[model samples]
Target: MRAQRKGPRRRRALITGSLGALVFALLTVNILLGSYTVTIPDFLAMLGGRTIPGASFIVMETKLPQALLGLLAGASFGVAGAIFQSMLRNPLASPDIIGISYGASATAVAAVVLFGVRGAGVSVAAIIGALVVALLITVLARGRGGTGLILIGIGAAAFMQAAVTFLLSRADLRNAQDAMVWLSGSLNSANWERVAILAVALLFLLPLTAAGSHQLHGLTLGDDTASGLGFNVPRARLLLTIVGVLLAALPTAAAGPIAFVAFLSGPIAKRLNGGVASLHLAALVGAAIVLAANFAAVNAIPGISLPVGVVTGALGAPFLLWLLISSNRANQGG
Candidate 1:
């Protein structure tokens, strides 16, 4: 028994260490590979608070904040994704895939294009939108099961997409361009302020997520089983869902919906950790994905810089399709 327990712990440690190293390496590469290159010496110097002429401004103001946001937002999305996937007992039930991110996006876009809202106002609008959509899904899927929730979310996403399109069509050229860039999840607008907002939000949400994660594990055993074990199944589900929505909303507000970071992170982490659920590992994986994707977007294709979402969408779409086909076949088999 001791040996078996130690074996899983050792594996979990190895996985966590690997993910942490990957995130650190990606973060280093992201900070180092911008328009104006900052050498290792210069990076060290900047870290030590010694300005290295032109490099300091670029590194400190531009690359630093961008890398930080990617790390923070990616972790937020990853943890959030893990919560939803674990709670719903379906890998396809991620915030981005279903409709939570879309809910935030639709409202933020409307605020930007229709009411000319920006900055903090837009963030607030996004939070409201996410909460509203979550509530709607819960109500609609009452007693229906995970499949029902997923189907309802997909429908809500379609409606949100249409609303975003209509709002964009009504806006002027300049506003439309801004809206499009945001919708595509560009890191070009990243700054210390935005990073701070996400960081602060995480500081609050993460503890709640941590506490709720235990309940999440109980949930994986099914509601009746969990209830028999003395858990309030419905209350636990509601708390976890709310935490997941907030996690999804904050990042969407900070960096736009950023494609499938939320959708991809949990499965990738689960795969890496040998099918064991580790929210910490998932968060790290999420950060790595966003940071790596952003690095590729900016540097991989020479001369043409793409939005982070474009790259993520390109990667996630195929996976989404495969999941759909597999699920369909499984249903048919059943």
Candidate 2:
């Protein structure tokens, strides 16, 4: 039996690793192949600290930063999804499902339209808004069932959606159109400075995730059990909530809440790895999905570009509905 289990595990590891490598290589090629094709030799020489004037600026300005955003956003969404699913003990408890992205989007849009805030200020507002909604959901669901929390999150998300609709209705036509674009995610206009900001967040969050891995494992048990295990359950939860909100918020701020990457990454990783629980695997899968999706979004069609959010939503919405249906059936049978 052990040998049989080991065989499947080895196969899964090999498959997951192959998938990750292929995704990364494809993303690299896509990044280099856009608009002006920078040959492999020139691209390497440019990165190796030798100046190929136009190539250096193009690499520095365009591909490098966007690639970094894709990486950071993908990793953040992936890890956040894993943490949320584990904490809520529900596969459907991802931030996207719980309306974390909606909260961020609502607040950022409010900032842009009502307050005229831009740049880092928009990001900060989105973070604050997401935290507020997350707290409300947590507080309202305290001492209640996990299903209660899920329901409350849905309500919060709906409220955010309404708010966005209201804002769009009130705005002028051009502004409304622009708002529509943001309501869906886009990474096309990202700059090097945005990349720098996301990198800083990753620098902090990745190490923090490493240190908190043990706590996350404890969380897979019931709260009481986790508390009994010497984990500060409330504090740990608070930290996780903050991490998740920021993870969702930062990307929303930069890329406009690309939907469903956060929702899909954990499950896809689990499925691909045959139920492995490694956060690293989840991150890898998340990065692969985002980069791969972006590559398709950028190059899949001519004369028109689909946003990353659109591609993810196209895939995520149907899957999310299926999940909801499956959960309902299981509950009925139980």
Candidate 3:
């Protein structure tokens, strides 16, 4: 019995450690391979507050904040995705898929195109939009089951996407270009302020997520079973859902809903962990995916830069199709 328990624990540890290492490596590559290359020694010097000519400015101002944002935002999206999937017991139930990201995107696009809002104003709008959409889903699905929530969310997302398209069509040339880039999710605007906002948000939200995660196991066992186990099923579900929304929103605000990081991270992490829900591992995987995608966007295709969302979409679409097909086959089998 002791060895049996140890085996799984050891496997979990190995998986977590491997993911952490990968995230670290990708972060290093993201920082080092930007427009102006910064060698390891110069990077250390910048961290040490020593000025090193052009290297200092590029490393400190541009690459560092971008890398940091990718790390935090990716982890935020990943953990949020894991929470929603685990709670809903559906791999397709990520915030991006359900409409939370579309909510943020629609509002942010409106702010930019209609009211000419920029900078922090757009971020604030995005957070509010995500929260409102989440609330609507919760209220609409109140008496219904997880499937109901998923269906409602999908409908809501389509509505939000239509709003976004209409707003973009009405915008002028420059604003439309800007909105399109943001909708596609780029870290081009990454700065210290954005990094600080995400860092602080995560500081508060991560604890809430961790505290509530254990309840997920009970919730996953089904509502009746969870209630019988003395869990306040509705309250727990609501709190976790709110946490997940916040997690998804903060990153969207900072980075413009960076495609499918939230959608892909949880399922991939589960596979890596041998089919167990590992939020921590998922967070690491999310961070790595963002960094790698960002890196590829900048460096993979010579003489042309793409948005991080473009790369993530290319990677996630196939996975999404596979997941849908597999789930359908499984249902048919059942």
Candidate 4:
């Protein structure tokens, strides 16, 4: 018994620690290795209030903010995606796959194109859009089964996507370009302000996620089972759904829906951690994906620093098709 318990604990710790270290290394590289390289000693000196000529500005102002935002946004997307997938028992139920991210994107685009909204207003619009879509999905799917909910969410995603397209077409050239760039999700606009907002949001959401995590776990056992285990199924689901929506939305606001990090993170983490829906692992995987993808985007091509979304989208689309194929085959077999 002791051995059994220790084995899983040790394994979990190993996976967690290894991923944590990888994320740290990637972050360090992002901060220190760019067009201008800053040595560790100089980095430490910068932290200690001594400024190097070009290194200080590049590392402190550019790389650090971008890397931090990527980490936070990636973790947020991962946690939200994990919550939705685990609770709904559907891989396609991720906020990105469903309407939540689409809603946020659509609203943000509209705000940019139509209302000339930028900066934090776009973020607020995104959160509102996600919440509205969540409510719409829930209300519409109240009596319908899981399939109905998924379908509705997909439909919503499609509609909002169309909305974004139409708005982009109507906008002037300048607004269109700016909106398109933002929608493509670059870390170029990252700064201390966005990082701070996202961090504080995460700090606030953490306790809420922890408080409801117990109920979330219970929920995976089915509504009846969860109720028998003393969870109020409706409340738990609502709490988690809200949590998931906010998690997905806030990151989208900060990073412009960085293309499938949320969708990819949960399953990747679960596979990595031996079939457990580990949120922390998912968060780490999310951070790693964004960091690595951004690194590649910056250095992968000559004369162009592609947006982070481009790389993630290129990676995620194939995996998504694979998932759909696998799920279809499983259904046929079953």
Q: What lDDT does candidate 2 reach at residue 248? A: 79
TM-score on alpha carbons, each prediction: 0.97, 0.90, 0.96, 0.97
Model 3 per-residue lDDT tens digits across residues 230-276: 99988898799889988998899888888889999998999988898
Poorest 10 consecutive residues of model 2 by lDDT? 272-281
RMSD of every prediction: 1.4, 2.6, 1.4, 1.2
Ranking by TM-score: 4, 1, 3, 2
After superposition, candidate 1 runs with Cα above 4 Å error: none
Q: Write the per-residue lDDT of candidate 2 for residues 219-295, one digit (tens) a residue.
A: 88979999898999888887877887787788888878888888888888778766755677788877787787777
Relative to the true structure, how large is the alpha-carbon lDDT of every model? 0.91, 0.81, 0.90, 0.90
Tens digits of lDDT, candidate 4, 1-334:
9999999899999999999999999999888886657889989999899988877888889899999999999999999999999998877789988899999999888888889987789889999999999899989998886678889999999999899999999999999987777788788789999999999999999899989888878988888899998889988998999899999998898888898998999999999888878888999999999999999888887768889999999999999999999989998995
Cα lDDT over the full model 2: 0.81
Error of 1 at 156 (Å): 0.1
How many residue pairs clash per model?
0, 1, 0, 0
Instruction: Mark the 10 consecutive residues where model 1 has the least summed lDDT.
Output: 33-42
TM-score of 2: 0.90
Candidate 2 pairs with clashing backbones: 252-257
